[model samples]
Every structure is written in structure tokens, then in C-alpha cells.
Target: MSENNNPPEEKKRPEGITNSYRERLKALKQARQYSVAGDIPKAVERYSTYLYALASYFGVTEDKLSPSFFDTEKEISELLLISHAYWDLSKAYDRSPNLHKESIRCLDQFVKFTNGFKYQHINAQMLKKFIKRKQAHNMKAFQNAYTKIQVDSKGCFIASYSYGPEHTVTNDLRKFKQAIVNYRLGFRFVEVYYNTSPAIINFLEKSGIFGCLLNKVFIRPTLLLISKSARHL
Candidate 1:
């Protein structure tokens, strides 16, 4: 009998990388369900856990991981720009004692990334301002300050504040801060429009459309409110 000369077949090893996005997405979906079900703590846990796994897969710290990790081009896309979906998980941490630090950490990483692009500059600045606002003021009070000014699309200004019977000096300060936030919101809106569509804004401005927008009668009263609030602050 002739000896067999064929070499034994070598079994192939599995690829080192697995796309875990499906699993991450499943976790996110579960989180949303839990959130809708009013199980907020579980939802936060699920989202934070998924974020940790995703960051580990990318070999980045959780705070540094970005949506670009999931992008084929590994660069900016409309998903990252228009959606801001990454902040969802981070904001979830806001309600948890242990997770709130992680929330700020993640926001810090995003703020750092924004420095690389001019379009994100205002967002980065605003994020930093938000962080400062969180640190310098009580969170509940800060939130109160955020809710005072309501500007409708029709250019109407609806302002509400509680000076209260005590009227302590701190109340005045709080009112001032709220006024500043309201003032910044207007500037921020314009910045967002310019950042989102610079070419269109430029065309509009050159055609005098932007001037017409700025000329709205309601704007004068809004500025006056800001002026009064600044003085009080």
C-alpha cells in the first residue's frame, strides 16, 4: 500500500474583531424601553454599560469614545452633527449620584473634540459654560434659571421669574444669571444657524433677509429685559 502524502488541513482561527454594534444597539433599545417603562435607573445602567463596552471595544476611555467609532469613514457625518445622540447616555448619568461624574467626564471629552472644528466652536463654548453654570450654582436653581425665558418662533417673549417675598440678595443674583442665560440663548440660536448652514446664512444676509429678521419689533423688548436683568444681577 502506498503511504498517503496529503498534508492535514489546518483549521482557521476566528477573526480577532467582531462588530459589536448590533449588541450595543440592542442594549440601547432595551434602555429606551426601560426608560419608557419608567424604570429610569435600569435605563441609565443599561446605557452606561453599553457605552463602557463600546469604549472598551474601541480601546478608548468611555469619555473619549465617539459616534465616529461606528462610522465607516471614521469622520464627521450628518448623524453626528444633526442628532447629537451621544449625549443621550451622558445625560442619563445626570440623575445618578455615581454616574453624574461620568456624565461630566463624557461631556468634557466631547467638548475637547469640538475644538477641532470651527462649526463646533460655539457648542464647545456653550458646553463649557454649562459646566461652569453647574459648578457655580445649585443644580436645581440653575435649572430654574434655564426655564424663565421662552421665545416663540413668532418672536414673542414670555418671561417669568419669582422674586419671592424674602427677596434676599441671592434671589437677585439668580435672576441675573437667568437673564444672562436667556440673552445667550438668542446669540446661540444665531450661531447654530450660521454653523449649520453658513452658505445659506451668508446668502440671506447679503440679500438683506437677515437684516429683516433682526428688525423684528419684539426684539427691542427682549433686549430691554436683558438690560434690566443685567442691572439687577
Candidate 2:
């Protein structure tokens, strides 16, 4: 008999795990494409599929795939991806009417999985505060608080912190934002400011003296310039 010359066949991944991984990849691809296309509902559907498949690939149920079940040191990347998916899902739910409770649940999961990571554009701690405030108040109260948060998140962190939410200076800053936000450059500046200012304000608030100093040295001076500019507009 002729000696066998062919190499042994490579071992295949378990069928279930292989299928789960393939589904996860497919769902993730569809989710991102739908998101980029601004088909939020479709994106949300695909994201849900991705999450389920990810859990299956990891040999766990979706709820059991949280940080509590995973080894954080070994699986930080996986946890972060899960956190990001939850965050995106939360944002999608927020845009849908009658899904506030679902949005809050997804935000809670995002916060849980994002324990050590810091994101500039989305303040997870601030989002937790909003969630707590929403649960403790009536719908109207929650709406007002949510509106204030949305406004504050735009670019008025220091102004809102120093002068109070209703202060004339804060109102003036908001009006200035409205005036300039119509222009492309102005909008981009506000976008950058919004992404960066929250962390600065968070730090300042934690240190009282620094907050005071910043208000006097930077915020007040900027407010003065804004006031002067308002006269010209």
C-alpha cells in the first residue's frame, strides 16, 4: 500500500461556537452599517442579535455575560465591546418614544461594564445621575431635569456650575451658543467643547478651590468677552 502523504485534517472549532461567532460577526457588521445609514431601528435589531451571539460564543446567557462573570484582567477588551454596544443601544432606545425604561436599563448595563474606562463625549457618571433623577421624579420633573442635562452637556459646564443653572450668565452663554451654532465652524467648536468640558468641570467641582479659581480666571473672563460680543450681535 502506498504510504499516506496527506497531512492530517485540521481540527475544526465546535460547531455551536463557530456558528455563534459567525452570527456575532454578521450581526455586528449589519448593526454598524445600519447605524451609519441612520436606520436606527434596524441597527438596534442587529445590535440585539450581536449581543446574543456574543454571549453564546462566550458560553453564557446574555445577562450572565457581564463583568461579574468575566475575568476582567483577561477579558477587558470583550467587556469594553459589550459596554459600547450597551451604550449605543441605550442611545437608540432614548430616541424611541415609550422606551425610557429600556434606555435606563441599557445605560445601567453600560455603566456596569465600563467600570474603569473613561469616555470624553459621554459622561457615564453624569448619565447615571440623570437615570437616578429620572427614577425619583415624576415625568414632568424628569423631563425638565433631562432638558437641563441636555443643555448643560452641550458646552456650558463651567458656566452652569459656577453661576447656577438659572443664572443670567448661564442663560447668556446658552443664547450665545444658539447664535453661533448655526454656522459650521461654530457648531464644530461647540462639539469639541462639549466633548472636553465635562471632564474639566467634573474635576473642578471635586476640588472647590480649583473650581473657584477657574471660574474667576477663565470662566468669568470668557463671560465678560461674551457679554461684550453680545453687544455687537
Compute each candidate's TM-score over C-alphas: 0.40, 0.45
List the lowest-lDDT window of 10 residues for candidate 2. Answer: 1-10
Which lDDT tens digits does candidate 1 get at residues 1-233?
01222212334322231234335556666777887898878877777666665566666776667646544243344223312334444556665676666655544444434432333534534544665666522254223322321111111111211122233432343344444435777546533533443444344357575544643444335545554665745
lDDT of 2: 0.64
Measured with C-alpha atoms, the lDDT of residue 113 in candidate 2 is 67
Tens digits of per-residue lDDT for model 2, 26-113? 6777898998999999999988987887676556876666777656665566566677688678777876568877776776666566
Q: Which ten contiguous residues of candidate 1 have the minimum total lDDT?
A: 152-161
Error of model 2, residue 215, in angstroms: 29
